[model samples]
Target: MASGMFDTPIVGVVNNLFGGLIDAPVVGRLVRRGLIKIRYVGRRSGKTIQTPVGYRRSGDGVVIHVMSPDSKTWWRNFLGEGGPITLLNFDGADRTGHAIASRDEKGRVKVAVQLG
Candidate 1:
């Protein structure tokens, strides 16, 4: 009776719920420490989308590992070469970056971003 979080049906619900918590004024303070809000434009749809994901600082930028890659589509936008991205803290302070997504031989996906 235990369904996975990415098991369709409720993926959007989970994203919206977590996204709201990460963007909240008070609760976001702790959550945003490890999970910041990421905003990007869809390459094909030309629409702006915001999602909350876990990331860590890497050199001058940050690295985000996409969980259950097959269940997600956002990272695909950064495939091939890369694209412009904006990472925002709970306070709404954003850091602009260029993101390139790569996959290991094991099919694990991760996005390496260079902040500017």
Candidate 2:
């Protein structure tokens, strides 16, 4: 799948093969249209995080999926500070949000990050 575009050759091949099992473009479209919202939590501080992922919307509240398989810098910061994140939305406004995820959630924020 196209998701493998961000990975090494072998990993990309694996990602392409695995992505075939899911409708990523549909989900991406849903996410872009604001129907799907992605919620991230601080790995260390237990705070809610929200960000408008690049995708289109199918309707309202469709599942937002993650493509990468690792942690990011903001994820690390969220872990250090436990509080809900207010993400910037369309019209340059901030959105009030919270995040709650279980082990079975579509995506999970982990406790790893690079700060350089």
Candidate 3:
């Protein structure tokens, strides 16, 4: 199924719950297996936003797949290919990187980050 199909309010609640657990000690270790916490500054608001996203490490960078591209705006901040972001890796280290967002013909948004 397309990731967008799961972009409901209930999913947001569940994602938030997982995000909270991923910040804890033991639980975080388990939760980090499938999710990552991305820290980025809001483009317009200028406030720091933290959200849990599914990601995979590719070579020297990480790729994040946005479930609902149209409904989400965080990816917009990386459109110009120079947005700074922090990815909390499963190893418990924060990796600083620059990210660029792009969308496929299917409207799937992918943000690739090159670690610094």
Candidate 4:
């Protein structure tokens, strides 16, 4: 694996071999508390589009960082057709957040802001 490429297998290895429990809640807490960042992938293209996303304590007030990247098909659908964002907690419970970014500003610095 390439450097800094800590993929799922590596995570699984750490979790299995060292008994490290790396789940959504722990990761989400890191993201929530601003320890680590949360990245969002484009649903259609499966590309990493958002990084350093900010999440609120209640899992609301989600801010996405696109880093000046072009919008993808999934983002288009999310903007046009209106889609649901499924956020899973550590307990495997999925929470729904609403996409509330305006069409005119979707391509700007602020992409989509999901609020619970």
lDDT scores in order: 0.86, 0.37, 0.83, 0.42
lDDT tens per residue, model 1, 1-116 = 22366666676787788888887778978877788878999999999998888898888988999888977789999999899999976346788999999999999999999998
lDDT of 4 by residue, 1-116 (tens): 12233333564454343222233445545433532233345657677543233333434455544333342223343555455554444224545565533334465533354645
| Candidate 3: clashing pairs of residues | none
How many clashes in each candidate?
0, 15, 0, 0
How many backbone clashes are present in model 1?
Answer: 0
Error of 2 at 77 (Å): 7.7
Off by over 4 Å in 1: 1-9, 90-92
Which residues of candidate 3, in runs, are more than 4 Å off? 1-12
Cα displacement (angstroms), candidate 1, residue 50, comes to 1.1
Error of 3 at 75 (Å): 0.9
Tens digit of lDDT per residue, candidate 2, span 1-116? 23344435765465344333222454543333543233456566676754333333223212233336342234334333333444333223444443222223556633221111
Q: What lDDT tens digits, residue by residue, belong to model 3 across residues 1-116?
A: 22464656786798789888888777888777768998999888999998888888789988998877776677888997559999876466898999999888888889998999
Pairs with backbone N, CA or C atoms under 3 Å apart (clashes), candidate 4: none
What's the TM for model 4?
0.40
How much does candidate 1 score in TM-score?
A: 0.85
Locate the minimum summed-lDDT window of 10 residues in model 4: 14-23
For all predicted structures, in order, the TM-scores are 0.85, 0.31, 0.81, 0.40
| Superposition error at 20 for model 1 (Å) | 2.1
Pairing residues by index, what is the TM-score of model 3? 0.81
Top TM-score hit: 1
